[model samples]
Target: MNVAINRKLILNILLFVVMIGVIIFVIRDSLSEIFTELGKTSWPVLLGVTMFGVISQVIEGYTIKNIANEFNREFSIRDGFFASAYATFYRVVTFGTGSIVSEVIYYHKKKLRYSEGTGTSALRMITYKIALMIWALFFLVVKNDAIQRYITNGTFLVIAGIFVTLLIVSVLLILSLNINAQVLLIIFCNRWFKHQKLRDIVDRINNQVYSLRAAIKAFIHDRNAVIRVFCSNMAKLVVWYFLPFFILVQEHPTIDIWLTVALISFTVILGGVLPAPGGIGGFEFVYVLLFRNVVGKVDAVSSLLLYRYATYLLPFLIGMIYVLFNKQRQINHEFKKAKKRS
Candidate 1:
């Protein structure tokens, strides 16, 4: 266990280094350009971006609260806020994908049993991804012309096909999870693990998946809960996707909002496959690549900076501070409890 933990720590460090390196690489090429653009950004715009940053997280916390309440009665808005903040914070800091694990852990710490926490997190994950892809699909359709021209036929076809296929699979996966997660036995029953030791691990995973689905079925069975979850998650996503559009327009009014939405959303979902948490290096790389096509170097850098601060960096800082403050509060609460016991 200690070895496993150490390995995870090392891997996270490497990913963090990669993020830093990518940021440096971007800055290295256009150091003066990036700085000048940043300098030109006015204070009011930054402040507005900061407020939107808070609004985005608050909506996210509310969504988490909605789902968590079904399974964990003790769940409150305050706890939900911290959970959302911590989830974002850890996802930004931690290296590997499946950043929702942090949110699951947050739920467990607050009141949920492991199974309940993991189940709700998994359910929310499916819902959020479905919404994200839907948003991606909508924007892609609206900006199909620009996108197709931007990347020619063969490349465009392959990516669009992949996105469509993933959406189909995710829908099928959700159906299977709700009806009978054992549906996986059809595939996993085969001797795909290669070795007996690995086979044992696969068996363990099968059992865990079964348990997680059962927990999901318990609370998500309610019709109203399901609708609320979907609507809330979609709203949370809209705030995130379009918050930058507002900022970018303030900088360059003629800029194509749908184009910005299409590319950023694409890059965000595409960057998830990278090992970097929260799409670290790949996200900025693709954003700059896309932005350059639409605006000058100064506008490109400035727009991306505003977007990053409004949605990503500012949220990260706020989340980090919330986590630290919560940790300190937890310590104090524990000390008081111990003192009362004594």
Candidate 2:
């Protein structure tokens, strides 16, 4: 067991290193230009970007707090923020796979049951998806002409994204609310799969689905919490969508904020369709493709770099600091307890 644990730790470390290397390689060409643009950018604009970025993460923390409070009123905002930061760190390092695991473990450490933790994570994800679709649809309609004028295929992409998102939400709802569907799925899997391991995996998934169902039912009944979660997520999306505009607005004061928001909404929707981790490669591609005509190639590249820094790097760095500090505090507490025992 110890050997297995060690091996897993080593693998995770290697994966983290590899992810960092890939990120650096992807941005290698633009590093110089990004720095040049940074030098030219005003301090006030940079500060504004940083402020909004921090605000977005805090809102995410609050969203987590609100959700967890439904399950356990003892859950505090601090715990929520810790879980949020921890999840963000793992999400980036593990290419999005570790986010759910990270949050579950964090919540469990905070004394929530495993099922509660799982439910919290699952509900948070559902609400986030719903919020994304809502904002995407709203902006898509409000700024339809602007998006069409900028990108010839913008309408099609946004509509396709909305359709796919809706489909995913529908499936989750069916699984959560439809007991017959769940039973049939389990029965089908049990009959089709002969291997014990595959069967065990399916059983575990079924159990998780049950937990999610309970969470969905509870969350749906609490209309106030539902509204707050949606509003918080919408605010986060607004900050994210407008970040690039702020990044470039100093140089291009005439750039339309509404148009930028529309373009970003389209980019996010299309980017989410891709399987890339944290929407890294897919998001950059879509952003550049959509913004190049409006901002020109050089500015688009530079603005994207800054935009990425604000949206991705800042939150990640903050999360990393919080995680490391938490670990150190744990170690110190253990040492104090050991000393007292001695």
Candidate 3:
């Protein structure tokens, strides 16, 4: 057990180092100008942006807590926050694959079953997609003319994003609701793959699919919890989408707030299409490409840098800190328990 734990720790540390290197490489070109913009920005504005980012995470934690309670799991708000933070940390370092692993481990340690953990994480993702789709559609309609005027191939991108989002949601629903689909999927895999090992993998995934379907049914039946989680997700998006506006508004006080928010929503929708971790490179590309038409090149880059700092970097750092602190606390707890036994 200790050997396995140590190996996992080593792997996570390696991933963290690689993630930092990639981030630096991605932003190296803009570092100088980003620093200049940071210098000009007031401390108060930076603090406000940071606060909003913190609030967004707290809301995410609340959503997790509510969802767990709906499932009869004994999860506290603090546990939710820590779990969400570590999930974010792993999500970044592992190119979006490690979030679920981290959450399942965290939830298991918190006394919840692994299936419960997986189900909760899956539901959180589904809620986020639903919220993003709703907000994206609303803003697309409200600022349709402005977005089309500024963004190249804006209509196509919006349509593509909507289609992609809808496709994902629809597929998840089908898999969860249709046992026939699950059976057919397993049968197809079995028929084509001669490897017993591959067949075992499919069987494991099929079992998890059963758990997820139960979770989806529970989530749907609890209408009030659904509303609460959905609203919290929307609140999180609002804070995230408005962050760039806050970063730029000090200098460009004449910037239209709604237009900025709408562009951000569009950027987020399109960014999801990219497989990059946390949508790092693709998100920056889309943000700069679209915002430059409205805010000019330099401001676009500067605001994006600051916005990334506030939303991405800040939360990630906080999560890392919490992870370290939690580890230390666990060590102390074990030491005390051992001492008492001795």
Best by lDDT: 3
Give the per-residue lDDT of model 3 (tens digit) for 1-342. 555555555565565566567546534543455556667778998788779878888888899988887655578878787778888776766667777888888888887778877888888888898888998899988988876897666878886898899898887778888999988888899899889999888887887778788878888898988889999999999999889888888889999999999999988888866445553587887888789998899889888878877676666667777776665565556555555555
Per-candidate RMSD, Å: 7.1, 4.9, 4.7
- The residue pairs found clashing in candidate 3 are none
Regions more than 4 Å wrong, model 3: 1-41, 193-204, 274-280, 333-342
- The deviation in Å at residue 282 for candidate 1 is 2.6
Full ranking by lDDT: 3, 2, 1
lDDT of 1 by residue, 163-184 (tens): 7647755654564475454555
lDDT for residue 135 in candidate 3, whole number 0-100: 88
> TM-score, each model?
0.74, 0.83, 0.83
Worst 10 residues of 1 by lDDT: 26-35
Clashing pairs in 1: none
